[model samples]
Target: MASLSVPINPLPPPVNRRPDVKPEISLTAKERDEEKRRQKVNRKIASQKATSMKLRSEATKAVIGDKSGPSNSKEPLPLLENLRAHIAALRWESALNVFDQLHEQLWYRPDSDIYIKLIVVLGKCKQPEKAHSLFQAMISEGCGVNRESYTALLSAYSRNGLFDKAFSLLEEMKNSLDCKPDVHTYSILIKSCVQVSAFDKVDSLLSVMASQGIKPNTVTYSTLIDAYGKTRKFAKMEATLGEMLREGQCEHDVWTMNSTLRAFGSSGQIETMEKYYDKFQCAGIQPTIETFNILLDSYGKAGSYEKLCAVMEYMQKYYFSWTLVTYNIVLEAFGRAGNLKQMELLFRSMRSDRIKPNCVTLCSLVRAYGKARKAEKILGVLHFIENANVMLDIVFFNCLVDAYGKVGCFVEMKGVLEMMERKGCKPDGITYRTMIKAYKKGGMNSHAKELKGSFASVQKSSPGLERQNLQHSVSRFDSNPAS
Candidate 1:
């Protein structure tokens, strides 16, 4: 201590020492608190803006009604826009109401698109008169009508069995409107003529189309072929196909080939159908499902299991994916051939392939099982139908009831009837007749009498009930004249 003091020469007055000084921050507590509050407010404002932008985007999309891409254009005026939306949604009456409002409020400008849309809607709604009136109004307004407008009207009339109206429209399209009858227009008119079995008109239409330089497309050829086939005029069908080939304008497409095959099949001309099947491929046209279905159906109807199997094998080899109709055709073939084992195997295979059997398939199987007197198997099919939620139509229900009744399983038949009623499906005359037949076979005369009465009542209530009742009654009377 004494040595240190000797080196310090009169130490300066004790320097005032202070603790380490911290940097002086600029913000005060009040300013920091204010800054935090401002930040929170800015975040809230940004969030609100983002939400508003999202809402606007959704609203814009709703207005534009496009499947893809952004809708930039503002929606059309409210009345017209609403009317269009209603039409798009198929709310025909509502759309008509809007149209009426539009006519009253806005100036009545004959917009071709609107008129077309209205006509289509009315036609779909089965308001043919309204559709016709709209068409007349459009013409009166001097609106330019296109092919679609005339075609739509013609189709409506055709569907309703108004052949005269359909023909008149066709003539007007050609004569008054000066719209050349294209293949489509001609096809519609031809189809209508065929529906009415007006073979003469179909021939005339085809000739007219040919003379006008309007080369018939695949549809035209298929329609004419179908018409000729319906009337069992195979010679005409052949001549038509020959003409198509000779014209150099039309080729033998799959549809034309299929139509010819169907005609042959329907006429039980299995040999001819097979010949054409070979020729179809030789003509450099690929066979389609329609071709296979026609051949298979023909073979099935003829109970030719060998031919059906051959066709199915060919289908598999060609990698043609089997459809419900394909399976149904084979099922029917096996059924009619009394090849129950093969039919069952095919039905099981259908399920294994994840192909759900439709009403047609089930009906075929039920009919087959009934014919084989396999009541249990038919019940199993009914359960499958239920499990798959497959809706049973009149034909399906009739088949099931008949199958159960054939085996004298009154309980199961009644169960099916009750289930059908629960599902709001009214049994047709065939169903009642089948039930009566089963009751009679089982010697349950009381039930048979009741069912017969019900059948008569149903027929009386609904006129023109497809004549299934009359056919069934005749068969019953033929079998048991005493009844």
Candidate 2:
């Protein structure tokens, strides 16, 4: 028994058990290199995708019609696309650089499509002179100009108030290109003539269009009506409408009817406007936003706020949303009528509807506040103007200063002047005149004298100003210190 126990004890010396350990993993050199390569490839793919997206965005901005780059350049289409995009995006200098990169054959090669697109882009960028030059270059290159091209050029000139050039181009189209005036051409010319009050020229153009067998479309009638309305020639507008009706050519188009209604509304002929509305319905025509706007503006101008509200209600019922111009019209009417409460309510309604108040709206509010003698409210309006970044023209600033000065807030007036100066706006004659009047009223004789002297100095520096009248004003100020 003792021997057996001794043997068993000797057999079991030590049997130590420990927790299992995981083996460390390590990549081979080749594996590590391959992994790095994969990462680089992924990065390159991402970079390429980003670049493609950028190019697409740029190309969209350029409004490129075709995918093919200029035929001569072997470079990537993206490069040319980017250039065109820059031009469309209004990066004129960058666009020029792109054009420089294009093949010489593409440069100044009159692509009517390209020319028309560029003309529209440049006009939007307010580079009308450059746009005109491009048009001339197109013609010089013997590129056949299309009606669309001529129309774009004419529109650019008209928009920039270059009516002389616009008319010259029209004549060139008729004489050199033998391009008969289309309905759109006549409409553009008629609208331009209306704007410049060239009624006789508008009539002559219409006559020419008729001779060319170009029927006076609805737009033609609308243009003539707008022109007559602008000149307050109600009789002419009515007579024109009558002629259209008698000729059996009176299609009761919304635009045509609106134009007539607008003319009547603008002239404050409420009865005539109503008559047109009845006639429009009788002719089975639906009134558009323009029609409602015309009626609203007319009612507003005539100080018939009740009628204005009724029209606004009609607009809502008809699902016609109000535009900024609509609000502006109503606000201006209320301001003129000295209805401050109504103005405030309208402003609140506009804000509630998320309609951004423009400079005109703020100006109208300020005017209403001034009429009500609510100095605090006027200051609030000024604050809104500044906060909203609505540009305050000289007239607006002058009005504010006058309003504040009238309320004996000389400090506020000076503050506004300082703000204008800080914004890089120089005080004009109107500004100085307003300041002088304020100082004189405030009995700050020395300040008024200083302002008068400064005005005189400016006039002296710029001899074109009529300084004699200002000198007389200064003498009056000197003689009457209390004034």
On lDDT, the leading prediction is 1
Ten residues in a row with the worst lDDT in model 2?
A: 474-483
lDDT of 1 by residue, 57-159 (tens): 9988665555222343223477677987999888988998887766554235568889888887877677888889999998998987788889878877876
| Candidate 2 residue-wise lDDT, 129-239, digit = tens | 988898888798788887888888987787677888888888877875556458888787788678878778877887888788877766777677766865778888888
After superposing candidate 1, which stretches have Cα over 4 Å from the reference? 1-114, 117-125, 139-142, 146-148, 169-183, 203-217, 457-483
What is the overall TM-score of model 2 with all chains considered together?
0.67
Q: Cα lDDT of all candidates, in order?
A: 0.78, 0.75
Model 1's TM-score against the true structure: 0.71
lDDT at residue 102 of model 2 (Cα atoms):
53
